[model samples]
Target: MNLVQLKMLDAIVRTQSLSKAANALHKSQPALTLAIKKLEAELGFELLDRNQYRLSLTEKGKLFHREAAQLLSAQSYLTQLANELALGNEANFKICYEQLCHAPQYNDIICDAFRQYQSTEFSVSSGKRFASLEQVNTAQADLGIGPWFDLFHATGDLESMPIGKLDIGIVCANNLVPKRVKYKQLQDYPCLAMFESEMSFDSERLSYSKGSAIMKIDDIATLKSFLISGAGWAMISLAHCQSELDSGLLQRVEVLDREHTFSAQIRVFRQYSVHHGPVARAIWQGFKRASEQFIND
Candidate 1:
């Protein structure tokens, strides 16, 4: 009938004794009994099996309690959110990251932030190319993590900190190309590229031979599939395809172009000269600390 009555039923179910539930809730046993009786009258069904030795829900009571539990959880969360907001925490924090930032330590950092800021809703999304930076710059995300290409540095409206480095190599399925091949020879095969039309920066450099037939694909998983099927060769992060490379499903081509093997500094960035709340500040600091640990390791 009401939260108080629903809570009483929940306590009774948990404690399995009306007296114990009354003691736990700091209410008189008679009042607890009366509340449940009223709730049953309103619901037109008994919520408990009074004849049970300890106490238990009736068949219908179990269904009702299941739904009531969700309401209680929402109430608790709302209370916590109110308290957190009173302390000046942000209501939401969004992070957009590239696949290269999916390292264990980075994931741990995000988890730690969540634990520390339970009331702050967290949104995380993975993007390709310059999408992360674009999200941060456009105020769509509170933070961004990805490769620190020259364009990212050139973005005057963003502030960035180097977190680590990503090793990328030009690779193809073993059957698609020779172990050692010239850059020009790669032109004959299609190049799988991850391109987002809204934010393509330095994308051309991702392919070793620009003359190669370009196959623009935004999804990394699909692109990897194409490479594995000898559909095309691509410049892929060593981290993303390490297992494949190890198992010989994919092979890194030895291209004459020394730059075929590329290394880019991974960075975490946010909009420049913008104020952030406690949750955002805590996450940012956590990231910086993680970056330091990463470098030392």
Candidate 2:
């Protein structure tokens, strides 16, 4: 049978119900049934037992299932290999930045280039402040933008470029808390802590022992929502949360330690590959210009 028929068989087997598989695949139950019946007829053997109520694969079905999965996995691997070969270092330029504040500016530059040259595609993801660098090392990401720290100093594997620095502050629902606060005073209230990837965390500095009552989260977008909902106060870049603060939707909690700034740097990195494709070179040039403007602004 074809890949579609095999996929349907596998989905039905894993889900244990034709109706559930049909719903998940966004196909009518009747269409799914016909596909299964067709597969069975072509094989000259029963693939499923309808009387059991639970979808159970027959002996032939089990044999085909294993083979089908192997085939699909091989196909997926081949596609990824082709994509990597074609795109090279420009396959994915990952950036770790404040979703609300930094993303807009980054998107503007990248999208503008896309509109003009239309030469590459981008996929963006978010992580805790520390994880961005790790993503670069793992080849899961090609670039990163986040708080500057000593991680790069130790590894001697990355190049950190300073972008525009933004002041970090506590954000809360308007009128929900005092306009200003002391660092120690923060222990009295719940704090929304955004955790970075495991590889990014510096066990010495990021542990809960520091002082605030923390509710940790890994997703950047979700963390913003919690602050907006007034569930808790969180540390965020002032540039990112300015609109909310100005609109009275969220209140800025000024902390006593004004000098305790988190310096943000956009670090562009790649493996020491001898060959960087045209797309990679073009994107890297764009990023360099973006960083220059980012720091200047």
Q: List TM-scores for all candidates, in order.
A: 0.66, 0.59
Cα lDDT computed for each candidate against the true fold: 0.81, 0.66
Candidate 2 regions with alpha-carbon error over 4 angstroms: 1-101, 112-121, 207-212, 257-261, 267-274, 294-297
In candidate 2 the C-alpha lDDT for residue 279 amounts to 50
Candidate 1 residue-wise lDDT, 1-297, digit = tens: 789998899899877899989997999999999999999999999999989688899999999999997797678668746765686677888998886556777778788889988877899987667778878865688899988876665653688777888998888998788777777787888888887534535456644666878888777788888999998888888888999999999998888756578888889999765666778777789888967876887
Candidate 1 differs from the real structure by a C-alpha RMSD in angstroms, to one decimal, of: 17.3
Residue 139 shift from truth in candidate 1, angstroms: 0.9
- State in Å the error of residue 286, model 2: 1.0
Best by lDDT: 1
Clash pairs for candidate 2: 128-196
What global local distance difference test value does model 1 have? Answer: 0.81
Residue 284 in candidate 1, Cα distance off native in Å: 1.1
lDDT of 2 by residue, 1-297 (tens): 888888788779767899989986799999999998998899899988777879898887788888987786566557656776775534444444434335555566556555654445666676665665666654566665656655565542565556555567667888666777666665577778776454534553654225656778877668878888887787777776778888999987766754333545444454342234555456567777877887678
